[model samples]
Target chain A: MPEIILIDDPADPRVAAYRDVRERDLVGREGLFVAEGEVVLNVLARSTLCEPASLMIARKRVAGLADLIARLPEDVPVYSASQEAMDAVVGFHIHRGILALGRRRAPASAADMLAGLGEGALVLALSGIANHDNMGGLFRNAAAFGVDAVLLDTDCCDPLYRKAIRVSVGAVLVTPFATAQGDLLEVLTAAGFETVALSPGGATRLVDLKRPSKAAVLLGAEGPGLAASVLARATTVAIPMATGFDSLNVATTGGIVLHHLAFAALRD
Target chain B: MPEIILIDDPADPRVAAYRDVRERDLVGREGLFVAEGEVVLNVLARSTLCEPASLMIARKRVAGLADLIARLPEDVPVYSASQEAMDAVVGFHIHRGILALGRRRAPASAADMLAGLGEGALVLALSGIANHDNMGGLFRNAAAFGVDAVLLDTDCCDPLYRKAIRVSVGAVLVTPFATAQGDLLEVLTAAGFETVALSPGGATRLVDLKRPSKAAVLLGAEGPGLAASVLARATTVAIPMATGFDSLNVATTGGIVLHHLAFAALRD
Candidate 1:
């Protein structure tokens, strides 16, 4: 069982890393990330892609989470503090009372991840998705649709951002993803992926597009959609929508396209 | 052309409806709703279902939006204020510089809204969806997929709430919706509709389900998905997700289901 340490003061050096979470998130956490709430904490405990560094819980929550705490590795420390102290340490009022510090494993290179996929793998590639909520939503949808991996262009926001992780309901913890080192499209092409870029003005309707054995679906931010150069190389597909309406939210677009690809793959 | 009136005081009576927007949204706005940003204001301008009650814009924005303001009905009042004064009036920093108070045409009864649908109509029914962002997202997806009308059970939040309208990117203004007065499912059934409820343990996979002539897809809040009683009465359909994963976000689920129904209808 992991050791339960009682912490009475917010300034305890042992819990120093948990200080001012919101501000720290705006800066960087070195190589670590904070996971909040019971749901995400549970995901961190069970996640193979990331490891929980430590846990801090409200003293009142200790009894309720005893079973979960007992399951933690012996090396992991569990700190119990008064809700007031917990709030002070975190620099915010987090009612959920459960927070975990997590460290992600070294990520594989984008090329390596793509090359390692099975012949029938489906991948989601994101470009310039600046909104953390959109980033999280894309990962949540990608995981739901069983995409083998996610590749992010350099301009995309970090999936492990506190808000993104929370918004994704812990999907960013479990989903395998890598940041692209070079041109994302070129890398995909070299790895044998039949790339499809989703845009409003596309040549093929999503309903009529044929699925490839190995495919990557690309999505960009809401306003400036996929780059023209990227669209030039990939099969451009559109999800038919009411005329004159702007494109669906990028994450919603991801869900629709991923579902179509996943369902098509399942049916055949 | 609409007249532009400048106000230097934050407490001006003419703009009282725009005061403390975040708090006002909670207290209810009588018969009015606030739409923010240029995008939604533009939608409100063109919307046939909702009329612009007034416009409050930052003084700096007046020049750039002159053409748009000129297109508005001369009867609608346009109020302009300095950015500082506008921020004071709204109780927050609304950098968007555009705000429109809109009055919805008295909504149609759920029965009448459903009864008026085309023979080949697709409707989205929502229950217990209390989150404003999800509510907005569902409406946005409904609009994107050409859903004829949205039926919201009593438990659902108002899609016209300021935040919901913002997250929906103005889709809420253009979509037709009704609040269900009686048992939602019973009303749906009475409208010559075949209802489908989405859940993790659904009886049919979304891929294999045959489309009906006029269908209503029901989605519930994330934790307590469609009431078991409703699920029992409707054809329960599941979007096949990865094993052991929880259900997708309610709005994401709406996008997938609506896309499927809309696309299937288009093909046949």
Candidate 2:
């Protein structure tokens, strides 16, 4: 079990990493990201791709989180602070009462990650998804649909962004993901993935598409969807929508498409 | 065209309805809701169910929005303020530069709203969904899927809440919605709608369910899902997910279910 260290001073140097969290989130967190709330901390505890550097918990919550703390490694420090001091340190009132600083393990190349998937694996490929909320939602859906891995184009925002991690409910901690700096479709094709790029004006309806043994659903930002070049190279598909409205929130679209692909795999 | 009334003072009584916009959003808009950004204002302009009471715009954005202003009723006030005055009045940094106070039309009872639907209709029924973002997302999906109406139980939050409206891309303004005070199933059944309640423990997989000519897809909050009483009264269905991972964002679940029902209707 990790040792419980009481912190009365918000400015204590030992807890320096936990200061000005929201500001640091906007600026980069260097190699670390803050995971908030108990549910997310639980995911971080079991995550293999990342390690918890330390934990900062409201003193009142430590008693309730005994089992959760017991699960973490012994060397990791668990800092307990009064609600006032905790609020002072984080520069905000965090009612969730649990926060963990997590560090990513060594990065994996997109090609290497895709090569590791099984023959019939499902994947999600994201391009130009700059919105943190959408990025997080995609990861959450990808985990639920059992996607083997997620590949992102260079233009996509970091899934490890604080809001994305919080929005994803910590799915970013468990789901395997890698950035593909080169042409996403070419790399995907090389890994035996039949890419289905989602678009509003695609020729084929999503329900009518034939399921591939190894598939990747490629999604882009909502308004300017998949790039024309990428769409031409992949199998372009559209989700049937109401006559007057053609757009669905990009993340919602991801959920729908992943559901179709995941269930198709189940039936087969 | 609605006349542009320029106001340099943040305290002008003519634009009193737009004051402390954030606080007013939380403490109820009396009978009005605030719509932000150009995209949502355009939706409000076209909506028949809700009419704009007044508009507050940054002085810089007026020239570009002439076409949009032309669409509003002649009597509706268009108040333009300098960026500083607008920010001071709204109690926030107004980056989107457009805001409108919209008043709901004569309220319709849930039964009456459902009664207005044609023989072949698709509906969404929500219960215990209090999150504004989820509420907005569900409405956005409902609009995208051409849902005839949305039925919310007493436990659901107001869809017209400012955050909900913004998150929905102004879909809440255009989508028809009514709140049910009593049992939701009986109301749906009375309206000649077959209710399909989605839950993690549902007996039937969503993909296998036969499409109903008139259907209402029922959803609950993410954690508890549909209540047992409601679940037993309706045709319960579950989305297939990876083993040990049954949760999907409530709005995402709505999207998948609605997509399935909408596409099935198209195929028929």
Q: Runs in model 2 with CA error above 4 Å?
A: A265-268, B265-268
State the DockQ of every prediction. 0.76, 0.87
**Positional deviation of A116 in candidate 1, in angstroms?**
1.7
- Per-residue lDDT tens digits for candidate 2, residues A130-200, read 99999999999998999889999989999999899988988899889999889999999999988899998
Please give the C-alpha DockQ score of model 2. Answer: 0.87
**Best candidate according to DockQ:** 2
Query: lDDT, candidate 2, residue B130?
Result: 98
Q: Give the RMSD in angstroms, all C-alphas superposed, for model 1.
A: 1.5
